[model samples]
Target: MNEFSDKLLQWFDHSGRHDLPWQQQQTPYRVWVSEIMLQQTQVKTVIPYYQRFMERFPDLATLAQAEQEDVLAHWSGLGYYARGRNLHKAAQIIQQQHHGVFPTEFDEVVALPGIGRSTAGAILSMALKQRFVILDGNVKRVLSRFLAVAGWPGNKRIENHLWQVAEDFTPHERFDDYTQAIMDLGATLCTRSKPNCQACPVQANCMAFKLNRVKEFPFSKPKKVKPIKQAKLLMLINNQQQVWLEQRPQKGIWGGLWSLPQFETDEALVAALNPSVKTHSEAVSSLVKWKAFRHTFSHYHLDIEPVKLVQEAPADWQGQWHTFTQAESLGLPAPVKLLLSQLESEYVKNG
Candidate 1:
């Protein structure tokens, strides 16, 4: 092992996070689940979800056998619906192709639905004690600053260079601890903003720190204005206090998740519900336009316009009507959940 790795490992033995839920058992299945959950999400946020997920589906077989809705329901508020969908799909593949065992081969692991190169490495190194290099977000920050790498790590040219650095620093022995140590360093000490350089183990040789430009090494993504997309959420209600919900298509945003019917405009919604607008206008009881809000995504901004329609006659809607309690338990987009909750609260307050 090199001096850099040695120092980091020593510090890790003393201060690194060793008691995370997944670390307790440290199986391939556990590590796989944890890695997926940690993608684009913080450790604190992933813990409760991870624990609840593990409790519900503790092993590969259980997860593989679970319904997609059940899996998504557990991951409802976690966001990034595709990850949950992929996790479930990957589990089924493992059951069918590998006899319900989490694959250990590097290529085989990476072939799974949600498992990427870095995630595959993490599952193997941390769970199987294999020597594999991982360059996750945290690792990228730690390495970019340590080596003073230029250009955003997302760029292919820069990413390849960072991958080499990660491979070089990785040790053959105690690969498990080394893998966890480096990630912990980035997450705890080498944070993106307000890093604790004094407590950093390798800060003495850190080029960015020496140059007093820790924030400049790992260049941020080139700024671009996120496009704004507008949509209307139709909350059709019946007398029994049930609301209309549709299962989103199996691909694209909020894939395979239950959500309110989305329409491009009020006219389009009216055309679908009532072909003759004049007759429909006379029969409708109450139509409410709630306050609009923005849900920002990585590539665009979603301007959500929620409309609550309390109609007496149950029109032949494309989706089914579910009670507020039933809808609460399904896999709903964060915005949809919030709107439903607000509507439900208002309904109870007046009565």
Candidate 2:
């Protein structure tokens, strides 16, 4: 083992986490699911979601057979809906192509949907006890600080150099422990902000720490103002206390999830509601406008204006009317869920 691995392993034995939900009764399938959920999400936030997901779809066979809607329902609040969709698709592919077994070969595993090189390496190392290098976000931060890598890791050249560093640090024995160790070190001690550098195991060798510029090593991505967009969300409630929801198109933001019908402007929303009338002035006047809110995504900000109309949806519209309880079970977006809770509370208070 190298000096880096030696110190990291020693630190891991004493301080690393051992009892995460996915760590118990460990399998390739469980590890795969946990890894996917942990991407861009913190460990604490993922625990409950991981446990609930494991409970619902316990095995590869079960996940493979489950419907897309059901898979998305389990992933409702987890913002990146594409990950859930890709995971379900990967499971099905594994079932059909690999005879329901998680592939052991690196090439085969990486070929599966959403399984990038780093993710595949992680699965092989952590789950299968193979000696493969992992350069996940945590590892990138750790190594960038260790060597004081100059550019943003998103740049291909910088990423390639980090991958080389990661490969060099990986040891031949106890690959699983090392993989978890490095990630734990990064997650717990060498965090993005206000890192506990004094307690770091490799503090002696960390070039960034030595230079007193730990945070400066891993350079931030170039900034650009996220464009703001506007939408009018229609909460069309019928007399039966059911809200109208439509499934978003299979590709794009909130893909394949059921959400409130959205239009670009109030006039367009009113026109859709009053298709038979030449002018929607009367309908627009009767609409109840709720407090607007902003939901920001990674690339854009969506300023949503919610307009509640207690009119039955036209039979020609392509959507479903579901009661509050039923809508809760479907794959609704976070903002939609918030609006729904408010609507439910209002109904209870007034009734």
Candidate 3:
């Protein structure tokens, strides 16, 4: 075996995960589903969702045939709804255009909507062992520090340089093992805040280790403060124990997910009432103010106020109640889930 290959393999045997859920049944379809879900999300959180999603749509044909709502609902709690949307789109394309098979070619994978070079590389290498290099967040941090790469990595020139480094380090033998090992190194040892340097396998040869600047090596970029956005969320509950929910529009933040009615402000909600809402006096019955919540997104923060409402509303509104026990049926975003948990606790306390 080659030097990097031997070291990587040895490091992997002792340290790498041989037990991830997707790893247990390492097929292309299973691997692809897990990889897409893993983007900008952590493994700790992805496992349960991965298990649930796969149970819902086990194969490429099932995913391709699923309705957009079913797909979105399966991806409800996971942020970055676009990933689910594009996964559905890509599945359809593969089923129709490519005959229900995930394309092995790197170029073909990247051409799909919402897939970039790194994600394409991940699918190609991990699923097919075709030897493409991935440069995800964990990999980027690991590489930048190991090589002591300077400049913001998000820059194109720097990114390309890192890509070359990635390509250089990848081993030809045991393609899948090596692909996962590098990511594991970053996730387990070379962490962002505080790394387990004593336990790090590559410490002996790591440039940043020699310099004692591992954290600084992956230099920071200037960041604009994430703008703060506010919304008023209503938790409209009837005595029947059903809550009102609105399906978000199919784009932008939390697109195609179920959420409580979110308005810019309480006043705007009352002023520009829906014609359907205006027709029925019963719909305006009673508003019970729960504690307001503030949720922060990547680019913006949402100051949310979750209010509880009682009384009969127009039955024509396109929503239904799934008593608290069946709340899982409605795919909810994180903030809505948070609100529900709060309400549930309140319900239990009152009981």
Candidate 4:
């Protein structure tokens, strides 16, 4: 075994975790779900999502047969909705074409909707024990520091170099444990802000530690300034206290979800939902009060006004009560959910 491998193995045997929930079974399905959910998310946060997701759809067949709404409900708080959609899509493909079994080949795993090379490598190595190398964020950090590699690690050239480093250090005998150890070390000890240099087993060989430049090797790329956008939210409340809600289209921003009827401005709002919308009751003749606010997203900012529609729904416009409890159950997008929650607290506080 290599020096890196030997030291890392010893460290793992003494301190590594073997009791993570997903480690219990290590089935291809279980590992696949966990790895996908863990992308750009922490292990602690992924646990509840992984458990709840497995509880809802324990097997490939179950996930394949689930409706989009039901799957979205299970993935409600998981933030990245596209991952859930891709998981369902991949499951369906496996169920129909492969007889409910994921293919073991590296290329086949990568061919799945959202499973890229590193994810495929992880599945093949960890779950199937096939020879492959994964290059996740933790792995990138670990390799970059150990080799003192320069340039942004995410760049294609640097990524290719780190992949070689991963392959070179990976123990052919204890590949799985080795793979998990390096990742665990980077995640737990060699963290982003303040890596515990003393706790790292490979510190002697780590070029970054030797040069005292642990923070300098893995440089980040320049960030683009996020842009801003605007929207208007219409809250059409009635005497029975029912509010108007609409189902977003199946593709695009907040797709395949239920949310309050929203638009761009007064002109657009009227053109869409409130075109000649009349009063809710004689007591509420017209809108005498309205509210406005703004929200921000990853790629852009959103300027929004949650306009209270004192007017009732027309006889032709189809809508329902959509209670708070039911809202929790529905797949409301994050922004809509936030507003609904704020409005609920305000409703209770005012009453």
lDDT per model vs. reference = 0.90, 0.92, 0.80, 0.81
Give one digit per residue, the lDDT tens place, for model 4 in 1-351: 899989999999989878888898889999999999988789998899789889989888899999988888887776777788889999999998788998998878899998998899888989999978888999999889888888898788888888888889888988888878887997898899989999889999999999999988688876878787777777777665556677777677677777787666566666554445553343233433345566666678787767676566666764556767777887777777877787678677978
Candidate with best TM-score: 2
TM-score of candidate 3 versus the correct structure, residues matched by position: 0.90
Candidate 4: lDDT of 76? 77
Worst 10 residues of 1 by lDDT: 278-287
Q: Which candidate is the best by lDDT?
A: 2
Task: Give the per-residue lDDT of model 1 (tens digit) for 1-351.
Answer: 998999999999999999999899789999999999999899999999999999999999999999999999999999998899999999999999999988889999999998899999999999988888899999999999998898999999999999999999998889889999998998999999989999998988999999999979699989989999999898888888889899999888998888988888776666667775665554334457888899988789999889888763336555788999999889999999999899899889987
**Candidate 4 whole-model C-alpha lDDT, 0 to 1:** 0.81
What is the lDDT, from 0 to 100, of the residue 329 in candidate 2? 91
State which candidate, 1 or 2, has the greater TM-score.
2
Worst 10 residues of 3 by lDDT: 278-287
Pairs in clash, predicted candidate 1: none
Q: Compose the digit string of candidate 2's lDDT tens values, residues 1-351.
A: 999999999999999999999899989999999899988799999999999999999999999999999999999998799999999999999999999999999999999998899889999999998888899999999999999999999999999999999999999988899999998998999999879998999999999998988869699998889999999999989888999999999899999999999999888998787787888877778889999999999999999999998888887899999999999899989999999999989888988
Quote each prediction's TM-score. Answer: 0.96, 0.98, 0.90, 0.89
Error of 4 at 107 (Å): 1.5
**Candidate 2, pairs of clashing residues:** none
Which has the higher TM-score value, candidate number 1 or candidate number 4?
Answer: 1
